[model samples]
Target: MKTIAIYGDSISTGTHGEGGYEAMLKSSLSLERVYNFAVGSSGLTRKTPVGMLEVLDKNPVPKDAELFLIWHGSNDWYWGSGMEEFSHGVKEAVDRLRAAAPTAELVWVTPIYRFECPDGMAQAGEAYELPNKNGYTMLDYYEELEHSSKRLGFPLIDMRRLCGIHRDNANLYLEDRVHPNRAGYQRIGAVLDREIQRFCIY
Candidate 1:
């Protein structure tokens, strides 16, 4: 029973703020509380008005929060923010979270594979092959996440690599290649549960 705080974009908001993996995790475990600070179209970059920094600024982290799940960054890739700006935003967000929740452990969940196809099985395109307007692929954004996790000294739950949701099986997990439907959310919830619970071992 941990009081977890979640931060992310539309996926974290979860079908009108009550339908994503956060809900699945809460219901499945019957956890006491979950503070969702996610907003639609949010990202680590400052380009978006509802960016992580903005959300953090608006919602102060509770002192009693035990775990902070900083799940974000997809919109940055989709909106075509450069890697350097994205990385800077991540660092700033992490620093602010650390300042707000000194005792809470932080986890970074990287963005998963995405295609434009919505609500169905993916076609033949790979996520990495599709670049945004700036010609930077989702892989670029994901790599930045890896670097930030290591540099910031936090665990990274790399969905792109580990979530089992990819071009081949996205139909089962994602709603629009961008957000997870019920099944997709559950899949992510299970992965998150397994990953975060490992922290209790020590």
Candidate 2:
């Protein structure tokens, strides 16, 4: 059986008051082995809650795993990482994973756009703010990584575009404005399934 590994942040952990897509994808695509190595509030940057060494030491990639799904950058982007720093972190992670799993394909999932908090939850956004914070939108960061993926020759999954397409159709997320609800996770899993089938299949 083929195997897939996920390395990412809170969204990957499904910590924003919602279940993650990892479990769903594992169940739906039972043919592929799945390992989720995600931490809450993580970032691509070494400064964040998790870094390459931590992920590697904690969750050693299984030799049989055929694909590595990298879904980081939310915390890094919000906490403050310019294109140069962001690209470096991502490249470093890619290099590490490549070294560990020489034959595995890498799939990079771009960060999603941030939504305006509902009036009641606006203050909540402020409490979680990071240092050197900028007012630039999340789309800016997503685009930066998207460009990097193009240059790096990795398959990029644009969650920002997916969210935009589905934003009007349903309650895609929770009130936290960060975590996606069950429906949202399902949506993500569907997209991942298609991408994995198209590109990562052995």
Candidate 3:
């Protein structure tokens, strides 16, 4: 079986339900070697330095693994990290993955739009001039990750565009407005499966 290592936060990890992209990918592809290495509230620049180190050391992807899917930045952006640090941390993670699995194909996933809520609105209200302290916009992180992937030669599947289709008319996301529900995750998995097939033979 072709192995796949998926690294990301709660969205990809399926913390809310057993319905994230990782689970869907396995079911769609009928592959059993897929590893879900995502953690809730995990940021590329984590509070604990050893957090990433521990993950890397424990689940180093083998050289022959078919692919590595990286779905990061939601938590980092949510934690109020700037572009520079976010970009750097993503690069570091990619670099470390390459070092661990030199021959593996790498697929990067960008963060999507988050819904605005009263609590977030209230946070922005503290500043008076600025509103929506959550700063959850589709435009914020897409281009950043796109350009970075171009520079680094990694294939990226833009989650914004995929999620955008249902974003306007439907509640694709859960109550938190961050994590996607089962239907949302299935949509995401379908997109990734198509893109990865085109990019990789497996």
Candidate 4:
């Protein structure tokens, strides 16, 4: 059995008893082990002194990992990190992962679509107070990551487009317009599993 390593945020860590998308993928793919190196409230860009990239460096993936899946950016957008900064963080993270897993295949999983939450947005905006706040959005982050993936020659899975989570299905899928519920996670896992099977040749 092959081992898969996941580097992500709270979405990879289970929410409300749901094992999140990574757990779902583990079960669906029937892999030997799935190492989830994700933390809640972590983003690619540093909102705090220690960010996801720093966390990853401290806790490296196993040497035997055959694949690496990188999923982040929700918190970056929420915290209002500029695209350029986000891109730089991503490049650094990818470089570190490549150095750690020289032979492993790397894939970038774009950030999922987050529904508009007026209260949540207002609170985050006030707390972060990022510059050029009006121009930042989840889609912008997604597009930038897509470009980065292409430039870096890494495969990408656009979860936002693939998952099809829209306003109508937000309640059923997402717990708080940002995190997905159990059913929503299952859907994401299904799509990821298919993508893995289709693209990853073990």
lDDT leader:
1
Question: What are the lDDT figures for the candidates, one per model?
Answer: 0.76, 0.67, 0.65, 0.74
Give me candidate 1's TM-score against the actual structure.
0.88
Cα RMSD (angstroms) for every candidate in the order listed: 3.9, 4.4, 4.2, 3.6
For residues 50-160, write the lDDT of model 3, one tens digit per residue.
234347766665666678888876555455555676667668878888887787889888776565432334432111122224553335556678878888889888876
Clash-forming residue pairs, model 2? none
Tens digits of lDDT, candidate 1, 62-137: 7777788888877776666778888898898888888887878888988887775211223324557766666677
User: In angstroms, how far off is 94's CA in candidate 2?
Assistant: 0.8
Q: List the residue pairs that clash in candidate 1.
A: none
Candidate 2 structure lDDT:
0.67
Off by over 4 Å in 4: 48-50, 116-134
List the candidate 1 regions with Cα displacement exceeding 4 Å. 16-18, 27-30, 117-126, 200-202
Q: Rank the candidate models, highest lDDT first.
A: 1, 4, 2, 3
Order by TM-score, highest first: 1, 4, 2, 3
Give the TM-scores of the predictions, in the order they appear.
0.88, 0.80, 0.79, 0.87
lDDT of each residue in 1-202, candidate 2, tens digit only: 3578888887787665356787777876674667778888777776666754467766767767788888876766555556577777777777778888888888888776444432223232321232235443455557677777887778887766764523454354544456677766777788878777777747
Error of 2 at 48 (Å): 1.6
